[model samples]
Target: MSAAGIGELREGPLHAAVKDLLAVPGDRAEVRVEGFVIDLVRADGELVEIQTGGFSPLGRKLDALLDGNRMRIVFPVPAERRIIRIDDHGEVLSARRSPLKGSALDVFDRLVSFPSLIAHPNLVVEVLLCKEDHVRAPEAGRSRSGRRRRDPGERRLVEVLDSVTLDSPQACGALLPEALGAGAEAEGFTTRELAAALGVRMILAQRIAYCLRAMEVLEDAGRRGRAPLHRRA
Candidate 1:
């Protein structure tokens, strides 16, 4: 098979590198299974996929494979990012550290799009924490404000930092910020309370609740004033 896209999806440099780093001696790369081009099929028959972006795109693969196969979806999160600007000739113009620091909890932000996937026993989502270089090149024109435009170029993995795997509902629930307390004491948190506990905006807290609820880790406990309360299931 070619080093082409998996199931017609193109692979970026970062995607390819992560796969190479994660593959073991007995693993098979770019194998076709059930009409899907899986990233890796372990010797033990577990399917592994590397997704460098959002979870929404895994819909088809999950729908088809999660029924009978143990599939692991690896999502790479740039825990530390360095922005590299390149000129027309691909020579580096400048490089700087990005101010945005990512947390493992960021997996919840993306999981909001496919919250219920965690409920699938055969599916495991692994958040691969990595240091990355985000390369960019000049675009055709400048903005209305006279600032130069840059294309969103490919990302290159600098180093593998750590990883967090979510294979069960309990694992998903453990991602909750510790400020919410633990176990029984963490129950009855409204979105407002969840937001405060998580130190995030109300919208993100709502998304977190939606994901946790779909995973069956959190259940409706009743209402506190206007906000609905949730408790550990």
Candidate 2:
């Protein structure tokens, strides 16, 4: 899917999740946070902010508010997206995790989802994971003599990526599938699998996965016997 198409896919699900989370007991009706105009509400007496895009100045403002009010920020952290810094007044409240590591968004999502998180009196941050599609090499077809022929769709995807600029790993991942002419149903490659296939380091492979996940092109199959596997709507 194109970037715009991916955004469209995220809209409904994200809105529903935010609405449901806000509707829980002790959760206040959705309201705009002062100054930033971000949609937010109080849940269990703690502020909950839903963020979708990057707004550094706005994040800084929210961090400042955390010093005075109990808050929990819920946002989608794009795969491989950098975490600049979170400063709560004079105290540094949070920092981005290591570069080229597993999804930062996934780590952030796990943190706030913990049962004990609601007990905290201070601010909390949660990131939701969204899967992305995969990019594959062009397919080869057999000729009359059993010779292989190149696929046009495969060439198209690569051409697209080569023609544009990519700002992040997520962007790279998103482009790759399209560039390589891999459709949505293409057998997706896992981080480990892709790493082994490409002869790259595990960290690099994971970063690529993170980007694809954030773009909603790949899906995570959660641990067995834990959470049920993620499914597309």
Q: What is the lDDT of residue 61 in candidate 2?
A: 54
Candidate 2 lDDT by residue in tens digits, 33-79: 45433344555456665554442434465556656776655554333
TM-scores, each model vs. reference: 0.85, 0.32
Evaluated against the true structure, the overall lDDT of model 1 is: 0.84
Poorest lDDT segment (10 consecutive residues) of candidate 2: 153-162
Q: How close is candidate 1 to the true structure, as a TM-score?
A: 0.85
lDDT of 1 by residue, 43-162 (tens): 999999888788788789888888999999899988999999898899998899998877667788888878887877898999988899999985559889998776888889999899
Clashes of 1: 0
